[model samples]
Target: MLKEKGLLGNIGVQVVIAMCVGTLVGAMMGHSASMFAPLGSIFIHLIKMLVIPLVAVAIISGAAGLGSSHSAGKVGFATLGFFGFTSAVAVALALFMGEVFQPGMGVDLTGVEGLFSNVYADKGDLPSFWATVLGMIPTNVFQSLNEANILQILVFCLFFGIALSKLEKDRRDPLINGVNAIVDAMVWMINVVMKIAPLGVFGLMADAVGTFGFSALMVVFKLFLVYVGAILIYGFVFYPLMIKVFSKTSPVKFLSVMKKPQAVALSTASSMATLPVTMEACEEELGVKNSTASFVLPLGATINMSGNAIYYGLVAIFFAQMFNIDLGMSAYLAIIVTSTLGAVGQAGVPGPSFLVVAVLLSAGIPIEGLPLLFALDRIFDMIRTALNITGDAACAVIINDMVSKDPSHAAEEKVQNA
Candidate 1:
């Protein structure tokens, strides 16, 4: 269908061109590029307006669909398992690459002393396990919705959906149908907002590059390059391999269809913002079932942070090597566990990455140098956000196959009857 729209009409191509042009404009205009910031801000706000309600309704519809079939618990477990396992693997891979490449060795921190500060020291103190658990249970769900508290919203919606599924069909079907309609309307709204994506992308990039020029990046250029390489290895090599081995879907076709969502992810740098596009690609293009896409994708976007995990792991190792701290087995273990879990705990929104402070502090690495990377986080965030959504789609495709094989699911029942 996108092919029928011609090259100029392809959002992916338009986004790529916008990114290039924006970079050029920013490089030339410097701080004057701030003039375009409003364009990007407006686009992001429009997308955010729909994300909360869309995620809330879609999760309800999906959970109700699966819960009625008695497969909700199984699918939930499978989804979490995939997200947790892949995230751990991503951190491990980043650690391995960091150790092998030694991106922080032979580095010069000569003039970056002013960038160092201890403001983020308190961030490393993560909340207690029980505190984290309690935080997910919103006392007033309406307040949670108003605050756009995604994790709490997810918890409430899932519970509501399960309860709804227990009702008789006479009562349940109408609410489910209504929720589905809301999800459809949300998608339509997302489609309308996406029309100006190229202009929004251009503004976002131009402001980012102009505000944080590549000057600081030169100091960490090696780390940047290695980080990109690791991302490519995971995105191009690992995800495709998993899809080819486990799912019936063609990995080549999966990659091809994913370009649209990936482009949006690249520009927005917020998986929550990119979610509607990701959902459309999974259901409409990649043939992921609507029920699976609705549940797994929202959950994945919330908890699945393989890309962020990699960043944490690598950054920990980078700082360690830079400081010449000889990390023992205990330190590596701390980095792995903290990076994986911290990444999962992170919110899927765009902003400074404070979670990295936790990873660094967990392993006794310094947090003072974090500002060096903070300035460049936007560039890094854009790239990894793309990979993050790709992981979401990969899991959806695999889980779709898994659900289709379970005879208790409605889709599988239909196939069996056919």
Candidate 2:
């Protein structure tokens, strides 16, 4: 029993061991970290490759399905509410956790100034709030499509879905049916890609271990614990309470159905990349209507990053602490506001959270405290990504419960079993 538990339930333990071994060899031989860089790059690329098509098809199909079932207003409100509530909760929880723990309290920040200064050099000017809002409107539809701008894609989808909802019943069926077929095919392709995901995860993990070793692991350990603890509180405590109050569902059961998809998100570390699996789990396993699942999950993948938002707060406090700087109440408030907006502003851009951290620091705070945190971003990113995806799935379940025709019957079979 002990052996099986250690072997099957503790991949993180094995990863630590690998990191120790790799670091010892590299240190002794004076080897370059570049030797292990390729694996991480390849894993990131594989995820990026799947992102564009997966998002486009998922959003389009979801939007179209929403149009077929309900008024555009209902669909729009539900999506907005889910994103808004989750984002608010995420930011609040992260701030609370950061204040209580102070993970960066004792870290030394000497000699790290150049690392952040160089990293943030070309990040350019931080856009104003109104400008960021304006940028959400795509100047050119095809250009936005080619650029894979998620907010732009979402804007287009909102209009497209509303138009589809307005179509006569007789005219809509054939179009919806055709799009559904294409979506089905695309989902299948995503599954085929997923079979390779474990390999990608393994390579990424191995390379991270090989390059950074135990010292990096310690930094990651601190970030990981803080981030994971915040997620558990949110996922298990906060979200469940919201479920009870607003949706009247079993949060325990909701989380159970979410486990498989959460695992997929952690392994992939990309919410958009995990959408195909999330959609399947919500529709088939959790029994959310396709219309609701399609609309909510894709939008959640793009914008609903509860975990990432939390990480942003925690890391911002973390860097402040490392620099022996006091982030007064005002600063914490600023972080809460900025991180929430930053999460939205940087959606669909690779590692934008880290870049946003640099922006926040440069805007004031301590610009030099970033590299102390960078060594562990990849590790916390995996956890944040998983939590983000879980939040998305949980919201889908709650929304489905609200809109189901036979709510109690659907709840009994799905929630109880899940």
Local distance difference test scores for all models: 0.84, 0.66
- How do the residues 285-331 of candidate 2 rate in per-residue lDDT, one tens digit apiece? 67777877888888888888777778777777676666667767677
How do all models score by TM-score? 0.92, 0.83
Backbone clashes, each candidate: 0, 0
lDDT of predicted model 1: 0.84
lDDT string for model 1 (42-160, tens) is 88788778778888987888778777665667789988998889989999999999999999998888766787799889888777789989999999999999998989999999889
Model 2 TM-score? 0.83
> Ten-residue segment with the worst summed lDDT in candidate 1?
1-10
Root-mean-square deviation of each candidate, in angstroms?
2.5, 5.7
Model 1 spans with C-alpha error above 4 angstroms: 1-9, 410-418
Q: What's the CA error at residue 106 for candidate 1, in Å?
A: 2.4
